[model samples]
Target: MSKTITLLGSTGSIGTQSLDVIRAQGYRVHGLAANSRVEMLAQQVQEFQPDWVAVVDEAAADKMESLLAGMPSPPRLLRGPEGLIELARHPVDAVLNAVVGIAGLGATLAAIESHNDVALANKESLVTGGHLVTEAVRRNGVHLLPVDSEHSAIFQCLQDAHSAKTLTKILLTASGGPFFGMKREQLAGKTRADALKHPNWNMGAKITIDSASLMNKGLELIEAVWLFGLPPEKIQIVVQRQSIIHSMVQFSDNSVLAQLGVPDMRIPIQYALTWPERVPGPAPELDFTTLKQLTFDVADEETFRCLAACKKAIAKGGLAPCAANGANEEAVRLFLEDKIGFLDIGRLVEAVVDSESFGGTYTLPDVYECDRMARSFVLAHI
Candidate 1:
C-alpha cells in the first residue's frame, strides 16, 4: 500500500529533501504548501502532481496560478493561512510540516485534530505550543513524529525502552554551528555571511542564523521537553563538534545509547515519514575506516546566552518560550537585513523574555497573541 502525504513547506531544505524521500520510497503526494517560493512549489506540483496545492503568500499564489495555467492539469490552488490550514485538514496518511517558524503551529494542530499523523520538523510547533500540541495528540490519538535530527535520534533510542521511567537523561548533541568555541566579542563583529556558513548542515537562512547564535539548540531543548514529556533539567545539551553523534539517551541503569550517522537531514526525514519501520535511505553509511575522533565539550552557556535564556524560558513556563521564539525570529530577520549585530540576537531575545508577561494556561489564540506581543516588542526596540 502506498502512503499519501501532504507536505507543508515543500520548497524548504527539509521539504525538498522530503520530496527526495517520497520519490525514493514511492509515496504519493496528496498536497503541498509553501510561503513565497511559488516557483519551486510549482515545479514540485508539476513533478508530484499533487491533488491540491497552497501558497501562503497571496501574491505568490496569484503568480503560481498563472505559471500553472496552461498545464493539462494543475493542482487546485489555495491561498493564505486558511489555505494552509485547509491543506492540513485534507485527508492524508501523514502531514510533513517542514515549515520554519511559529507559523507551523496551526497546521500541526489542524493535522492532529483531523486525525492525521504529523511528521513534524517545525520546532515552533512544540517550542511555542507544546502543551496544546501534546493535548491534541492525546485527544486525537495521532502520532507526532519528530523530524529534527537530534529529537529523532532520541526517539529512535527510546523505541525499545520498557518505560519512560527507565530513561535517566537525554544528551542532546549540537554541532555548535559555525562558531562553536567563539567568545561573545568575537561574534559581535561577525557578518551574516559568516554566520550562515554552518560547519555541518545545510539549512534555511533563519535556522542557520539561529544555529550560529546557538539558539537553535536552545529551541531544541524546549522542544525535547515537550516531545518526550521530560522536565527541562532532564535534558543536557552537549557540544559535539563532529555532528556524527546526533543525540544520546542515558538509561537509569547507567547504560547510554547513542544514534550515530552522517549529518544528513533526509535520514531523519525518511524515518519520520516511515516510522516503526526502517527503509533504505540515500544518506551514506558511517565508515569506521575513515572516521576520526568524536569529541564532546560542555556548551558555553556564558558566551551563547540564548542557551541559558531557553532554559530559563522553560522554567518560567506559559508564554515565555513563545515570547523567546517570537523575539528571536524578529531579531534574526533584523540581523539578516543588516540592522543588528550578531550578539544582539541573544540580547534581544533575553530582553523580550525578561519583560514580557503572558504566563499561565494558554489557548491557541493566546499563543498567537504572545507571539505578536514578543514580535512587537522586538520590532519597536530594534
Candidate 2:
C-alpha cells in the first residue's frame, strides 16, 4: 500500500537512503527537514514536493526561501529548531527520523505525540532519552521501528511471536571498525583521518570516528536496552569481522536466528518504512556461495573504554546514558576538529560519566538540562 511520510535529516546518509526507498516504493512525502544543507535540501524539495519543509539553520533557511521563490507551488517553509519540532508534529503515515544526534530526541517525541509511527534511524533518540521515548510510544500507541542494521536484524528475528516468547538474549554483532585489533598504546597516535577509515561501512564523520573508538557500538548498546527491554549483560557484543550476520537472537531452548545481508542501509530503511510487509528493494541479496567466513571475537572493552562506560551507564539506569551520549557527542566533535587526541575521546566521555550522578525520572526539559551539563563538562575539562 502507498504511504505518506515525513523525513527528518533529509540530506544525511540515512535520509538519502530513505529517499531512495521512498522513490522505489512510490511513497509520498509529506515533509522534509534538514539542518544547513540548503542546496541538497532544495533539490530534495523539488523532487519530493512535500507539503512542508523545515530548515534548522537561519542562514540556510534564508537561502532556501530565495531558492523556492521560483517554484510555482513551493511547500510551506518552517525555520529553526521550533520549525523542526513543528514538522514532526504534522501527522503522516510514518516519520522517518534520520536526524544524527541528540537533537533528534525532541522530534522523535513530537512524532509519537502526534501518533505517527516512527521509523527511527536516530540512535541518539533512544540512547539519550530511552525512557521518555519508550513511554511516549506506549502511551501514544505508535510503532517505534528500528532503522539501525543490528537492531533491525534483531527486530526481524523477533517477528515470530511463538519464538519471541522464548527469547533469552541477543548477540549484537559489530564490524569492529578500522582499529579493531589495536591496543591502547597502538591507538595513542591515531589521527582523525585514521579513525574515519571504517573498514566495513560508509558513514558520516562523527559516526565514523565513533565506530573507530567503538563508541558507536556503545551507543547502539544503550539503544538496544530500551528497544528490546534487555539488560546490558544480555546483549553481548560479538566482533563479527565480516559485516554480514547483522545480529542474532538466542532463545531459551538454545535455538538461534540470525539476519544476514549485504551491509546496505537501504534494506533496513525500506523494512522500517514497509514493515511486516516485505517488498523488493534496491539492495542486493547476500552472495553466500562466494562468502569466505563469518568469524567472531570477544569485544575488548578494556581497550575500548567507551563501550565499557556505556555498559556501566545503562546498568546504573535513569539519565546515565544521557550523560554518556552527551559527552561522546561533544568529545567526537572536538576529535574531528583536531582539538583532542583519539584516545582522549574515550577519556573525556568516561570522565564526564564518572563526574555526574545521572539518576531520577526526567522530563523533556530535564533531558536538555542533562545534555547541556554533560557538554559543559566536556568543554570545562578539555
Candidate 3:
C-alpha cells in the first residue's frame, strides 16, 4: 500500500520537504527531476533510490551521472526539459511538480496525459495553462492536488459536506510580504537583499522576492480561480502577516471557514500527498498557547500594482495570464539580479501585460508563444 511519488525539482524547497514527508510516511520515490544542483540531486538519489532521475542541467547531469557511477544501482539519468517531461510520463502513481517557473507547465501536462495524479506546487503551470491543465484533468480523470499552502487550505476547506452551490466565496490569505504597509515612495529604494527577507515563511530567493512585492499572492489569486473553479470577483485577498491562517471560504449562509497552521510548507505538502487519509508526520503542529493574536487587513493595491494587474489578467483570461506569468518571471529575475528595483518589477510586469493582446482560446502553442513574446517584451523594456 506504499505510494510511489515522482518528485520534479527534487532539490528545491517544496521537493525537499516532500521527500521528508515521503520518508516519514514510508512512501516510495519513483522518479526525481531537477534543474542544475547535481550535488544535491546526487545526494537525494543516494537516499531515495528512485527508478529514474532527470537533470535539466546538461553539465550538471554529466556530473550527477558520474557521481552515481559507484552506486549499487543508480537511476537512469535523463537530461534537459525534455527529460523532465519524460520523467513526468514515467509509470508513477503521483508526481510532485515543484519546478519553479513556466518550465513546469510541460511536465504538468505530461503527468496529466499519462494519468498520473499531480501534487502541484508549480503555480505557473496553472497560471499559464489553467484551461489546458483543468481540461486534461477532467478528460484523463486524474487527481490534481494543490501543493501550495493557499490552494491546499482551500482544498481542505472544501472537504466539508457543503456543496459548491452553498459556497459563496473564497478568502485567499496573504502574508503581505515584507513590504506590507510600505507606500510606493517608501519602497522605491529597497535593495534585492531587503526584498528577499520574508517575515512569515522561508522560501527560495525568487519566490521570496515575489512574496515581497505581493506578486506571489497575485499569482496565487489567478491560481485559486482555476483550482477552485471560482469567479475572480468571488475570490478575496486578505493580508494576514502572520502566515498562520492559510486561507478561508465564506458560504452563502454568511459563515466563514478557514485553515490555520504554522508557516511550514510540510503541512500542505503532506496533506496533498496523503490526501483523504491524513497520515501522521513530524511536521510542526501549530501551538495556540504561545500564539499571539492574528490580524487581517486589505492589501494596498496602489502600492502592490501586481495584485491589481493579476485581477486584470483573470478578467481578460486566455493568454493574458500566461503573458503575466512570463512577464513576471523575467521581471522577478531582473529584480533578483539587481538589474531592476523591486518596484520596477511590478512596473515591468504591468507594462508587458498591458502591451500584450488578449488572444483567442489557448492552445499549448498559444501559451508558450505568448510566454516567449512577453519575456522578449519585458527584457527589451527593462
Q: What's each prediction's TM-score? A: 0.98, 0.99, 0.98
lDDT of each: 0.92, 0.92, 0.90
Model 2, CA-based lDDT = 0.92
Model 1: residues with Cα > 4 Å off, grouped in runs: none
RMSD to the native, candidate 1?
Answer: 0.9
Any idea how many clashes model 2 has? Answer: 0
Candidate 1, 1-382: lDDT as tens digits? 4799999999999999999999999999999999999888878988999999999998998898998897789889989999999999998999999999999999999999999999999999999999999999999999999999999999999898594569989999999999988898898899999999998899999999999899999999999999887799989999999899999999888899999999999999999988889989788898988887999999998999888889889899998999999999999999999999999889889888888555789999999989899989988887
- Candidates ranked by TM-score, best first? 2, 1, 3
Off by over 4 Å in 3: none
> Quick one: RMSD of model 2?
0.8
lDDT of 3 by residue, 1-382 (tens): 5899999999988888989899998999989999999889988998988889999989988888888897899999999989999999986878999999999999999999999999999999999999999999999999999999999999998897655558889999999988889999999999988987889788998899889888888899999999988899999999888889999999888888899989999999999888888877868889999887999999988899888888888888888888888999988888878898888888877887787568678799988999899989888987
- Residue 91 deviation, candidate 1, in Å? 1.1
Per-residue C-alpha lDDT of model 2 across residues 1-382, encoded as one tens digit per residue: 9999999999998899999999999999999999999999989998999999999999999999998898899999999999999999998999999999999999999999999999999999998899999999999999999999999999999999898988899999999999999999999999999998988888888889988988989999999989998888889999998899999999998989999999999999999999999999899999989998989998998999999889888877788889999999999999889998999888888887788678778888888998999999899988
- Model 2: lowest-lDDT 10 consecutive positions: 352-361
In model 1, pairs of residues that clash are none
